[model samples]
Structures are given as C-alpha cells and as structure tokens.
Target: MRTPLGGNNLTAQQYESYPSADDTWTVSFNNSAGTSGTYEVYAVCLPATQAP
Candidate 1:
C-alpha cells in the first residue's frame, strides 16, 4: 500500500489449494488494504526421488 486507504475501502485476497505432504510453499502480499497495486504468491515443491 502507498497512500493507505480507509477501512471501508479495504482490499483482500484468498485461495484454496491441495499440496503434497512434501511440498514447500509460501504466500506474500495477501489480505492487505491500501492505495496500491501489487500482489504475489509463490510455491516451491520437490517430487519424491525413486530408489536407485
């Protein structure tokens, strides 16, 4: 947010996802309010390796 808006003019975001038990994930710039225009979400996961 830049200028910062009032409570009445609040902004929000949400998502639903089903990830693996070994999945690594993170979220950023979510459920925020203000006079801005920037939001992002990131997720990183590594698959299970097979036996040699």
Candidate 2:
C-alpha cells in the first residue's frame, strides 16, 4: 500500500516488495525540494498466503 507521509508538506511515492521468505515490504522517500524537514512512516500487515 502506497500513501503520503504528511498531507501536502511531505509525501511518499510508493511501497515496494523485497525478496524475503515471509511477507515483507519496504518504503522510502526523499526531499525533492532539498529542504530540511521531518516526516512519519506507517505500515501494516494484511492476510496473505505463504508459498510452499
């Protein structure tokens, strides 16, 4: 799931899936304007199946 970090002030583009045994994911962001600032990140887990 991709979402914005901070309303309009700051934001995150998207969440990506990394190679892992379990259902794991990652998200990243950077200051495009080149201004010092702070933001928050949130994550959650959804029902999924594990391949054999």
* Candidate 1 local lDDT, residue 37: 49
The clash numbers for all candidates, in the given order, read 0, 0
Q: What TM-score against the true fold does each predicted structure earn?
A: 0.28, 0.41
Model 2: per-residue Cα lDDT over 1-52, one tens digit each: 4334554554334445453446555555655655455555556667789999
Q: Give lDDT per model, in order.
A: 0.50, 0.52
The residue pairs that clash in candidate 1, if any, are none
Candidate 1: count the clashes.
0
* Root mean square deviation (Cα) for candidate 1: 8.0
Provide the lowest-lDDT 10-residue window in model 1: 1-10
Candidate 2 root-mean-square deviation in Å = 5.1
lDDT of 1 by residue, 21-44 (tens): 555443434456554544445564
Model 1: per-residue Cα lDDT at residue 40? 48
lDDT of 2: 0.52
Q: Per-candidate RMSD vs. true structure?
A: 8.0, 5.1
